[model samples]
Every structure is written in C-alpha cells, then in structure tokens.
Target chain A: MREAVAVFRKQILDTRKNRAVLIQFIMFPIMTIVMNSAIKVDDMPEFFYLKLFSIMYMAMAPIVSMSSIISEEKEKGTLRALMMSNVRPASYLAGVGVYDFQCCLIGTMLMSKTCGLDDGPWWRYLCVIMLGLVISIVLGASIGVLAKDQMAATSLAVPVMCLFTFLPMMAQFNDTIAKVAKFFYTQQLYLALEDINNVKIGTEGLIIIAANAIVILAFFVLAFRKEGLTNE
Target chain B: MISVTGISKSFGDKKVLDGVSFSVEDGEIFGLLGPSGAGKTTLIRVLTGQLKFEEGSAMINGKEVRKLTGADKKKFGVMMDDFGLYERLTCYQNLKVFADIYGVGDEEIATVLREVKLEDAVKKEAKKLSKGMKERLRLARALLAKPKVLFLDEPTSGLDPQTSSEIHEIIRKRKDAGTIIFLTTHNMTEAEKLCDHLVLLNEGKIVERGVPKELCLRYDHQKRIELVTTNGETISLQMDRENAKKTSSQIAEFLKEGKLSTIHSKEPNLETVFMELTGRKLEV
Candidate 1:
C-alpha cells in the first residue's frame, strides 16, 4: 500500500510538473464549457446543451490523461525503470489509474460549473462520474498500453473519444442509433446529465460498463505481465 | 549468494542463452566477461529475475529468483544497459522514489546520492543532466536499496575514464561491504581489477572461469623476452623457463660483448587471455 502511494505520488508530481498537461487539465474543460454555452441553439430542448457539454468533457478527460500516462512513460522509458522497482504491477497501475480518475472527476465538476448547469442533485452526478470515470480510464489505459508511442496513442485516442462523445448526437436521426448509443458507457453519464423524464438506464448500460472494466483491467494485467517478463 | 545452473533462454528459434551456468559466492564480486552478442546481458537479466530461463533455476539467497515475490525482489538492485530514468523527475526524486519502493528511509537517499557524487545535481531533472550524471544517478538508485545482490550490466559503458573510475570505486566499496555483485562488462581491465572470480562467456556458454591471474597464467604458458643489441638491433625470443634462463645468459653475454641493448620479459594480460579463449576481441 505504501509503495502504491509512492507510485501515485510520483505520477502526481510528474503531472504537476508538466506545464502543457496542467493547462490541458484546467483550461480545456473551461474552454469546452464556455464554447458550448456561447452557441445559441434554436428551439432546443432543455438540458440538451448541458448533456452535450458533459459528454464532451467525460470523453476528453480520460482520453487525454490516460493516453498521456502511457505514451509519455513509453517515450521517456520511465515505465522500464518503474518495472524494475519493488512495486507490484497491479499496485502501480492502480495508483496511476486512481490519479487519472481523480483528475477527470475534478475536470468534470469544473466543466459543470462553467457551463451554468442547474447542478441539481450533484451527488448523483458525482456517483455517475465516479463509475463512468473508472470505465473510461480503463478503456483509455488499454489503448495507451497497446499503442507503441505518443503519435499512435493520440491518433488512436481521438477517434475513440469522438465515437463515444458523438454517440448522442446521432440519436436525433434514428431511434435505433439512440438505443445503441445508450449501450455505450459514456451515454449512461450523458443520460444522467440530461436527466430526461422517465428515462431509465437499462441492464445493457451497466453490463457494458462492468464488462469493459473487467476486460480493461485484464488488458492492464496482461500488458504489465508481458512487460515484467520481457523488459530488462 | 547467487547460483545459476544450466540456464538457457531463446527468443523463438534464436537461442540467446545456451545452457549457461555460473555462481557467485556470498559477498564476492563476480564478473561476466564477454564481447557483445555473447549473451552477457541475457544472463544478467535471468540472474536479476527480469528474464526467465527455460531450462534452469537461479537461486538468490536460497530462494529461486524467478519465484520471488514483491518483498523478495526488494533485496535486489539492478542496473540495465538502457539506463531507464524518469526524464521529468529530478535526480533527488528519482533516487527517493526507488528508496521508498525499497522501503529505505529518507536519510539513505541522501547517503546514496552523496555516494554517487550526485549531491550537487540532486535538484536537476534527470533529462537535464548529462549522460554521465544520469548514469551516476541510475547507479545511486541501484545502491539505495542496500541490496544483498547488485546486478550491473555495462555499468561504465559510456563514461569517461575518470567517471568510470569513480563508479568502479563505489562498486569496490559495495563489494567490501559484503554485497554479492554480478557485473557484466566488455572492459577487460575492469574485470581484471574488480572481479575476484569471473566467467568468460561465448555464445551463452562458459568458455573460461577463474581469477584473472589464473586464466592469464593458464593460457600464456610461454613468456617472451625482448632483447635490444648494442648495434641498435632488437631481438625477441619465446621459450620455456629453462630455455628462457639459457636465453637470458646468452643475452647477458651479448650485452657484455656490446651486442645487446634493452631486454624485458612479457607476461600475458587479460586482453591476451580473452583473445586466446574466444579468438575475438572485447571490441568495446
């Protein structure tokens, strides 16, 4: 546990030291919130823009942070050194994942406030954010782990974020597409943010989130094991 | 104490380690001497528990290194050829993190930093430091654990002579403190000076094993005698001791007759011994 904390603390310290990362952590959410609110929608339903902003923030946060963790470490070869240490692979990933999740949650809260959302039942939103953050972080980390370098990480992450973020945007054209979108984990958080009346979260959403979490955790374990076995 | 017996590793069909076997006694400085592509690094990795061998077992302190848990791994310190460093971290932070991982106190961090002569640049981020400083910092982290066994792969590969000597000094001190050290290097001089016992590896096999002096004596049986004549002509002779003794008398007579100049005997060094064993040079 102490070793995990040390790894966490080191990652946090490293994150804090990077100026661009700091700006991305703070400024990007604020910009997204402000830019979404500035555009006037004609006869749009209530909470539509709020839901859109929340989805964008959710997708962006994990994509940026998780990919950065993997690609940057690979680029710098810090992962190799960390693997050589006494810390277990699981503990190291947990520490790094926890920090990534926390940053995303904080960024979500800041985005919520900046967009002038009603902030009704903030606790429920926080709960959803926590759960959704886990799913997104794991998925993003999987992508990061599989990517060879930063360029590959970014190129891969952008499309994934877009696929999840724009899922709801496709709902207007077809009801079936909206139903498919609801099966996406990010869509569940979007539903919570939209807070549409009589809308229920089906088993598919929960199963998708849980299944993805398990698979991603498995990937992380596999990646770490391979690294431990092969790396000098 | 570390023991590796009949260890073999292959990446697909290309065998990297072909049944290599060696042992390092407790508190002894054991050198793995080989040229590049001789499986030196692969053997080091296996001994350090970073790589697995298909055919043999490595026991460190009576426990199989391949089966070491997290706590057991803490008792080892390894420095690979890659010199992995957290580029964004300061020299101090890098050492501190490893110290913390190994459960060493903060005071030990400072002690190790000082030991590696990295005290002055402790605050500098690793990426900003020079290559020599980075290498030193890597060494410092390896030492911070106060490990029972230290594994160093090409530790002084890229350093200048002075920096290399400084690093060697620390290794000597650690060895003196009763730490079992497994050092792999192409520097024959370093192997000669630092190792109490050594194995010269070729294609993942132990081609030779002994102390430096022992191997030199074994391979270089006939010593050469160089004689310079009074007329400015140099003569070289190689023979057994009895023949050398007779040659020495003749050379003395030649000197008395004003026909001989400088004379010296040639004993084999580590480099000559290596060439005799593998028919190749330690090119690095």
Candidate 2:
C-alpha cells in the first residue's frame, strides 16, 4: 500500500510536468461546456447535454490524458524505473487507476455543473457517471500498455475517442449506427443519462457495463503481462 | 556478497547465456567485460532479479534471487543500460520518489546528490539535464538506498572521459565504504582500472576470468623488445624463454660495442589479451 501511494504520487508529479496531458485534462471538459453554451440550438434535445458531458468530452478527456501518461512513461523509460523498484503490478496499476479516475471524475463534475445538466441528486448521477468513466479509464490504461510510445498511443486513442464520442453522439440520428452503438458502454451510459429522472440500472445495462469493464480490464492485464510487468 | 551458479538463459532457440557463473565479494568491484553480443547485460539482469534464468541459481547475500521478497529486494540496487530516470520529474523529485520507497530521509538524499555532484541541479527537470548529468543522477539513484549490492550496466558508456573518470571516482568511494559492485562494460580500460576481478564473456560463455593484470601477464608470452642504437638505428627483437640467453648475449654485445642507446620491453595489455582470446576488438 505504501509502494502504491509512492507510485501514485510520482505519477501525479509526472502528469503535472507533461504539457500535453495538462492541456487535455484542463481543456476537454471546458471545451464541452463552452461549445454547449456558444452554439445555441433552438430545439436542442433534453439529453444533448448528457451526451456532450458523458460521451463527447468526459470520455475523451481521460482516454487522452491517461493513455499518454502510460505511453510517455514507457517511451521515456520511467515505467522501467518503477518496475525496477519494489513497486508491484497491482500497486502500479492501482496508483494509475486512482489518479486517472479522480481526474476524470473531476472533469465530469465540472462539465455537469457548468452546463447545468444535473439530472437527479449529485450523488446518484455521480455513481452512474463514475461507472462509465471507469470503463473509459480502463480503455486508456490498455492503450498505454499496448502502445510503444506517445505517437502510437495517440493513433490508438483517436479511434477509441471516435468510437466512444461520435458513435453515441450520432446514434440518435442514424439507425444502423444506433444498432452498433447499442453494444458500447458509452451508448448504455447515454441511455442511462437520457432517463435521468429514473436512473435505476437494468439487466441489459448491467451486462453491457460489466462486459466492457471485464474485457478492457482483461486486455490491460494481458498487455501488461506481455510487456513483462511480472517477468522481466 | 553475491553468488551465481551455472546460470543459463535462452530466448527461444537462441541461447543468450550458457553455463555462466561467478561470485562477487563484498566491497569489491567485479566487472563483466564483453563485446555487444556477449550477454553482459543479460548476466546483470539475471543477477539483479530483473530476468529469470532457465537453469541454475543467483543468490545475493546468501538469499536466492527467484524467491526474493520485498525485504530481500531492498538489499540491492540496479542501474540498467537505459538508466531509467523519470525525465518529467525534477532531479530532487526523482530521488525523493525512490527515497520514499526505500524509507530514506532528506539527509540521505542530500548526501547522494552531493556525492554525484547533482546538488546544484536538484531542482532542474530531468528532461532538461545534460546526458552526463543524467547519468550522474542515475548513479545517484542507485546509491540512494545505501544498498548492500549494486549492479551497474555500462554506467559510463557514452560519457566524456572526464565525466567517466568522475563516475569512477564515485564508484571507488562506494567500494571503499563496503558496497559490493557488479559492473558490466565493453571498455577494457574501465575494467582494468576499476574491477578487482573480471570475467571476459564471449557469446554468453565465460571465456576468461581473473584479475585484469594477471590475465594480461599470463598472455604476455609474445614479449617484444625494442632497442635504439647510438647512431639512431632501431632494432626490434621478440623474446621467449628458449631464446632469453641468446637475446641477452646479443643485447650485451650491442651495449659493449656502444651501439645501443635505449631499450624497451612491450607487454600485452588487457585489450590485446581480449582480442587474442575472442578474435574481436573491444568496442571503444
């Protein structure tokens, strides 16, 4: 636990020193709120703000910030330094997870409050948003492990951001896209957000969230193992 | 303080280390001298518990490497070929993270920073540090825990000669203070100057192992002598045990005739010895 906190503290210090991560963490949600306010649509859908907050910006921000964190460390050999220390894989992952989740949650809250998109009481909405954001953070971590460097991570991240952002944002308009989006965690999150008045999770919602979390988290474990997190 | 027995490692069908074994005494600097493909880094990795070997055992302070727990791990430190610094953190911050892990205090951090001559640059971000400074910071990190055993892989590989000498001085000081050092380098001069005992590795096998000067002398059979005459003429002679008497007679005759100005004997150095054994020049 002490080692995990050290890794977490070091990761936080590193993230602060990184300009690209700073830009992504601070700008993604702010851009969402600013755009929402600037482009005043006459007949905006009630769930439009939800999609912007959860799908377009909140989801994309953590992926950009967290994925680059891992890839940058790999490229710069900082991760190798951490591995050489007494830091275990669980501790390292937990540290990174804590930082990424906290940062993403803060961004989500800011977007929700700034856009006045608070559906129910803050706590209930926060719980649901956090579940989806966990998926986003896991996806980011998996990208960090798989990519050889920041450039490769950015390449992997674009498609991921697109799938999570556009697939759900545009699903309301297109039939085929909506059908495909149904299987995505972001789509389930979008559906959950659309009905903020009654935010009880159902069987399908539970399955989708669980599946996304499991598959991505499993991929993270496999990628880290292949990268020799335990062996060498 | 460290021992390895019959250690072997293979990457698929290509064997990188084969039946290699050596031990390092406490307070001694042992060098693993080899060319690029000689598996020097691999041997260091195995000893440092970073890479697992397929056969045999590596033990540090009488504790087997494979079974090392957190407490056991704290006994040693390693600086890999990559140096592995957090480039985004400041020099002090970088050391602080490791200090926190090792349960060390600010006084130790300051001492190590001063030891590596990095106290002035403590607040500088690592990415902005010069290559030489970066290497010093790495060495400083390795010394942070006051480790019982230190594994250094090509620690001065790319530095200027002066900086390399500075690093060697710091390492010598550590040895004086009773830290066992396991160093790997392709630099024969570094090995000759720093290592008390060294093993010459060729393609993952121990080709030669001994004190550097002793090994050089053992292979000094092809001794050559050069003589300059008073008339500015030079004579070269190869001396052997069988012809020693005749060579001395010839030299005496030359001196009596006042034809000899000066004479010198050339002994084989570590570089020549390495080439004679491996058929490859040590990379500069």
Best by DockQ: 2
Model 2 docking grade: medium
lDDT for every model?
A: 0.77, 0.83
Evaluated on the second chain alone, the candidates' TM-scores are 0.90, 0.90
**Native A-B contact fraction in model 2:** 0.60
Write down the TM-score of every candidate.
0.89, 0.92
Interface RMSD of each: 1.8, 1.6
Best by lDDT: 2
Against the true structure, candidate 1 has what lDDT?
0.77
**Candidate 1 segments exceeding 4 Å error:** A19-24, A36-50, A74-76, A116-120, A170-180, A196-204, A207-232, B226-235, B250-264
Model 2 lDDT per residue over A1-232, tens place: 8777888898789888778887777776777778778877889875466555666655787788778887877787767777677777678778887887887788878877776755564566678888887888888888888888889999999998888878887898999999999888888877876766566667998898799889988988888778744224
**For every candidate, C-alpha RMSD to the true structure in Å:** 3.3, 2.8
